[model samples]
Target: MTIIIMLVAALLPAVLLWLYVWKKDPQKEPTSWLVKATLLGVALCIPVAILEMGIETVLFGVDGGPTNLADTTIMAFFVAAIPEESFKLLALWLILRKNPFFDEHFDGIVYAVCIGLGFAAMENVLYVFNDEEWVTVAIGRALLAVPGHYAFAILMGFYFSIYRFVDKSPKIAVCILLVPVLAHGIYDSLAMSSIVDPSIGGISVLVLIYFCVKMHKVARKKLLALKEVDKCDNESSFT
Candidate 1:
């Protein structure tokens, strides 16, 4: 029963967030396509895990987390944000470039979010399994970490749609990968700093709280904007 609870705690956030983003899409992609995107995220865990660990070992030493602000920032940006978002963007591109269902501005957001949540669900479970105080870890992750991924996904997909349907130039194209990497790096740096430097941990937590609230609000607005964009696209089609 404890295991069951832990599993639920680990996964529920992803499911809820995925559903929230899916609901925001005016023209929902088929369920199977969405599932494929999600499963692709799950599938990506193997490669992402290996790459992250290898980078950390080579760059920072074996299993050694950040020791200071600089270390934390480096690990966050390189080990966590860059590779994760790159793989996600690559997956999004490979899957959706030729997809018929990926027709609207919002579809990018939907598929990207589905993939993010899928990765979050499995990653959360891994965290719970490894931690001694899994209840705390699970609860903390469900509240913050999973949502962080959700926010990053929204950022990625927002730019992804623009890059895909609006402009394909090198500048606009990079935003799909760059925006999410920056956001994820910032969030991870802040969060990791709290752990690495307990002296200012309180300050770090306060800032994280502020950042998360602001980020979620922005993510919501972006999704709402996508809905409006779909409406505009539809109206233009008939006119």
Candidate 2:
């Protein structure tokens, strides 16, 4: 009974976060794509999570602590960073990129964030059920992991928008996702590491805030450029 109560407490915050983000679309809301993307993100996380566990088993031993510096770097880079970023990218490509519904730069953020928040929601449920100290896990994920996922998605979508307009540089957008992945890995490493002081957690949170602001600026700039192009097109048509 006690364990069940703990799981409920942990799961509620994640569920609420998912619902809030899922409902946040203001215009031309994408209900079907959002559902599909979210489900796909959650599904991909399962295999990636399993692979991460296996890698940790061999590299960090069953206890999951690093055996050496190289192992530590690989664990952080591959298991934590690459898998998370790639899964979100896969969700975006699968749900939004090829769809006609993805008409604007803002849609990138919308669809990508929904998928990320979905992944976080499911990941949180798994942690909540498994962890004995479910309350702290729930609070930490609400305060940190969920926001981190949103922030990363925003970055992914932001660069993708840039790639769309800057004709010769499409592939660069994929590299841009690395920034968020690195930041995410750093945050995870800091929290997991015994070497660092707890106060530095603020730095990780600040990274998310920084990227959010940066992406907002980029989106605004892109929208303005698009508006200018549309105005030119309108004038040309009239002439």
Candidate 3:
């Protein structure tokens, strides 16, 4: 029963977020490709975990100590954000690079969100099941962490679409990878800081919430703009 609850709590937000992003696309991607991207995302977590452990070991030594602000920032950006987002981007590229269905601009967001949610689902299960206070952790993650992943993916896809369809520049493609890493790093840094200082942590949470909300709005607007551009391109192609 506890395991069942854990699975449901872990997956519910991911499914809901997936559906929301899917519906935002004016022209949907192939179901098969989306499924593959998601499965790839799940698989990517294994490597990301291994890489992060190795990095953490190098940075903090085998025996971890109390985290200071410097340690938290370093862990957040280099250890967590860099490894995780870099691999996720690699997974995204592998899944969609040669696929014909990746035609529309909005498809980038759709597929990226799918991969992001896949990672979130796997990650949520691990955290929720491992913790003693499973319910509190589950609920908090459902609200913040899952949505946070979605926001990060949205930013990734937004820049990625521009890189793929608009600019096609190496710099823009690099931005596709870096933007999300920066966002994820700041997010984790703030969350990790609370471990050392609860007062500062409280402020971090509020700021995170605000940042997430703003990011979601910006991402949504970008999606809509891309959809419009796609529409124009389709009409022009016909004429």
The candidate scoring highest on lDDT is: 1
Any runs in candidate 2 off by more than 4 Å, and if so which? 1-24, 62-64, 67-74, 165-171, 195-239
lDDT by residue for model 2 over 34-75, one digit each (tens)?
778778877877888987888678766787666443454567
Judge candidate 2 at residue 172 and give its lDDT: 70
Question: TM per model?
Answer: 0.96, 0.73, 0.95
Span of ten consecutive residues with least summed lDDT in model 1: 19-28
Clashing pairs in 3: none
Per-model lDDT: 0.89, 0.66, 0.87
| RMSD of each candidate relative to the true structure | 1.3, 5.0, 1.4
lDDT of 3: 0.87
TM-score of 2: 0.73
Predict model 1's lDDT versus the native.
Answer: 0.89
Supply every candidate's count of residue pairs whose N, Cα or C atoms clash at under 3 angstroms: 0, 0, 0
Name the regions of candidate 1 deviating beyond 4 angstroms.
none
Q: Write the per-residue lDDT of candidate 3 for residues 21-112, one digit (tens) a residue.
A: 88877888888888998888788888899998889899889898337888898999999898988888888888779989988888888888
- lDDT pick, better of 1 and 2: 1
Error of 2 at 181 (Å): 1.2
Worst 10 residues of 2 by lDDT: 191-200
